[model samples]
Target: MKNHRKGHLINKGNAPYVLLAPTILIFVLFMIYPIIRSLYLSFFELKSGCYQFVGLHNYIVLFHDRTFYKSLFNTVVYLVIQVPVMILLALAIAVLIEEKFLRGKAFFRTSVFLPSITALVAYALVFKVLLNGDHGLINYVIELFGAKGVNWFYGEWSARIAIIMAITWRWTGYNMIILLAGIQSIPDSLQEAARIDGATARQRFVYITVPMVKQIILFCTITSTIGTLQLFDEPFILTSGGPNNATITMGEYLYDNGFRYLKFGYASAIGYVMTIIIFLLSALQFKATAKGDTD
Candidate 1:
């Protein structure tokens, strides 16, 4: 009976693994295989359907590549500036909309979220027209206000600004929805108790509400960090990494290397570098948040 019972427990333990066999097989076939293949490719020099084992050459070239550095710098700049701005704006908006005193909350939420759901190509084209240097709607409006119309896409900084604006407009509302869910999950009794204790609105928020929602805020921070790190579509579609590569991001650079220039090995090295950077940054963010929570 003891041996039979032991065998039964062993079978029970193995049941989950047996059930998950297909999923594991698929993951090995799709994700694991590609990752291993890419790593192998990164170590080679490929030309004309022939390859040489030129280990670290692609990585060395990437280090000396000015375009790669420029794209890296631009990506870091966007992550630093845009992530905090969008997260803060979203938090504020979420708090406001979740307030009981706010009227027509549904309408307001929907309106704000509309931009996020809009097709990227459609919005990019619309913004291009609106921000046209001379005849664009925005420039025309600025002229009406007795201000000089600026060329948005012609200058490096101006082109980056356009990319930032487009990303912020599209994503802020999605962040707001996440924060709104966090806000709503807080117990109303806590707020009532604080109010009864003569806490001002600001004090209640700073002391109670913010502390309670700290985990959700950390979640948003990490997700936003990852998204900003992988940023590609907006910059690619809107600016095309112009004028003179000022707005180039890692993803765009990777695409250019792989598809346009046919430097597959070099592109794979870029991909590996990007993966490492993203991992380090995300780990740092997680550590900071965890430390803050502990303190």
Candidate 2:
């Protein structure tokens, strides 16, 4: 009986693989399989509940679609404007929060980070109401100041601006918290050394602090780039990509095709194209930052 029990027990040599089997299975099923399936499906069109193979047709059509170009352009606009402004704002706030002379550091840090935790749908709805042309709190305040209240969503630029503002408001604090952690990790001894060597506050920050936190900043930038490129909820809720599709983003466009219009193949093509763009852009950023470091 003892010999049988020993034989039935698994060998320790194989124990790690046995323990990892479930996780590996789940990952293959949920992540790897979906990615492979999506790539395969991108080459086929859905008709009458059946998939018809149409290799490269979806990709060809995607390039010619004016709406695709519009969404891509709009996403580029957001990427160009929102990312830099949010990163800079976060850096400034993080530096201020780390200042030794600052009062109520805990309270201020919490206040800054609060918006990042708010539900995306809820925040988008709130921004929509606040930016409403007729009865919004923003318009009301503008009226109080003796200026005609602007119809924020009626114009193309205005609608884009409203979305950008909402994105920044929600994310800036989150980035600030990350940047603050990076800032805090720097040795106080370095700053003290710089100060003792007749470095001004600005010089110390520019030279010592910024250099130490460069990698953290790079990490934040790459994540922010990915997030901005994949942005959807804010514009979807706030403007419904309104006023002539002025605020429609690539992600929203993909959602529209996949869920709204039921063009699964074309949507899958868009998804892969976006995947390529994101990869290229991230690679460029990595190359640029690395070159800067060398120089």
Tens-digit lDDT string for candidate 1 (1-295): 9999999999999999999999999999999998998899999987778988999999999999999999999999899999999988988898889878999999989988899899988998888888889899888998999999989999998888888888888889988898888888899999999999999988987998788888888888888888887888888888899999999999999999999988889999999999999899989988998898899
Clashes of 1: 0
lDDT of each: 0.90, 0.94
Candidate 2 worst ten-residue window by lDDT: 4-13
**TM-score per candidate, in order?**
0.90, 0.95
Name the runs in model 2 displaced over 4 angstroms.
1-11
lDDT of 2 at 22: 100
Q: In model 2, what lDDT does residue 108 have?
A: 96
Clashing pairs in 2: none
Candidate 1 lDDT for residue 202: 88
CA lDDT, candidate 1, residue 224? 85
RMSD of each: 3.7, 1.6
